[model samples]
Target: MIEVDEVCKSFTVRRRSGRLRRSRTLVGAVDRISFTVAAGEFVGYLGPNGAGKSTTIKMLTGILTPTSGRVRVSGLDPSRQRTALARRIGVVFGQRTTLWWDLPLRDSLTLVRHLYRVERSTHQARLAELTELLELGAFLDTPVRQLSLGQRMRGDLAAALVHDPELLVLDEPTIGLDVISKATVRAFLTRLNTERGTTILLTTHDLGDVERLCRRVMVIDHGRLAYDGSLPRLRAALDADRILIVDLARAAPPIEVDGARVVRTDGPRQWLAIPPSGNAAAVVAAVAARHEVEDISLREPGIEDLITRLYGGGVPADR
Candidate 1:
């Protein structure tokens, strides 16, 4: 569904060097990154601030041309065939709304139908389905300006899907949404991908979304592809450690264990970093022998912890 081959994007920006002097420097937003997304697959694109995630999305959506290399979506070059590609892809930006501010939700959807040149009957059928699926019937007649953040987001999702695009590109789709709204959106997306076979490429700072939705993930750092694989492989490749929170019967020094190291200590509780392959029983026994143990629990490494480790230059060369 999407392919990026050694793509690079750079921009020239001016910086003040002196009272009357400005220096122009070239900045690389995406630097020779290569990856592919097959049809019917859901992939997560992850990176921290200024890590070229948005730049890559913009290129894929034809908002910006790459400074070097190639970008193709649905077998067409996004830069040269943007108009044709638009019909096959849907984009939702959490920070921006596609609906007209003063228009009611119904009117905005009608405009979309016209813009996409969807048949009257087809548009009506699809709108009805999306309205039901996204639960937009409650605010169908409400002005977009009057809708709450969650309401506005649901309305945006409906607008993006009305055209029946083959690919859905989402950027921070759950940002600022309440817990219930986020769950609703996530469930809808899962159904869309599984039942409708719509390929998805999601980029978000929310690890919860990735943990629930993405089986495959790609991490980009400094505009380069640092890791590309399943979540399990990522954890193994980075040698991520499991966390053990042990609460002793009384305040004591950090627990001494051979396979685990105390990473944090607070009162009677101590957090230990146990190797992914380490024996939890052995660590617990080792701690219990030395401390007056009261409670103990194990937590597997989360996506956030793994990504933080990867971003800190711990990514394996082959991952």
Candidate 2:
């Protein structure tokens, strides 16, 4: 469980002017963002670059202090009780590694276990489970530097979980991973959340990660919370228009469907944006009856498009 109440974080960076004059400028990395994650919930935090997602995560994980407001992880204030809170949370940053480069994967995990003061038997048991679940046995003896990106990511994830933390904070966990490797990581996370009931807060640029792994999502933009709710709700709210692609037997003149606007035209194929209130089945029937159609397909807007629209200042309206 995690609770963040109107948390705000800002950074003062040095700005240089002409003639070598310098001044400090305060930039808000996170601006009064608030959300809560219940136990066993896998929530996706998503936004474009510099959207304050990482800032919020750092504040919750105790890596950075907030300028104002409050954050509590498992009933402990991370800033004031960092050590106690650290033991109850696991963090994996896709851009960084927690393991020492020269250390073998097993050795890194062993070190983490000792640092967390995990009992030997408990450590061994957890390690075994993680190794099997993460398929780390293939390269357990490989040094961190020698492993491939995928292997290193798995090693980092295993290290984070060795102490059995209740909450997992993952920032771009699947970045730069190949398809197979991404699937493996997602499968492991699915099992972890389903079986162990670990609360997971994942920040990712990959909408596929959110689609596959999270039922709920929180979108942030311009250092503020833009949207927070079930993924389906967000999708419905942003994508009220459906796309209808119809291919006629031959090239047809431009024509419009009632309550639908022509969005694209290519020879015989025409794409129309149909209002959600319009009957798609009736539209398709009308097209088929009026024209010699070869094929037709209906598509809803994708999550990525919705995110883009949200960042582009589109108003949120229900489908």
Predicted structure with the largest lDDT when compared to the true one: 1
Kindly report which residue stretches of model 2 are placed more than 4 angstroms away from their true locations once superposed: 246-252, 266-269, 278-298, 312-319
Clashing pairs in 1: none
Instruction: Quantify all predictions' global Cα lDDT against the true fold.
Output: 0.91, 0.89
Best model per TM-score: 1
Model 2 C-alpha lDDT per residue in residues 21-90, reported as the tens digit of each score: 9999999899887778889999999989899998888888888999999999999999888899989999
Candidate 1 least-lDDT 10 residues = 310-319
What's the CA error at residue 242 for candidate 1, in Å? Answer: 0.9
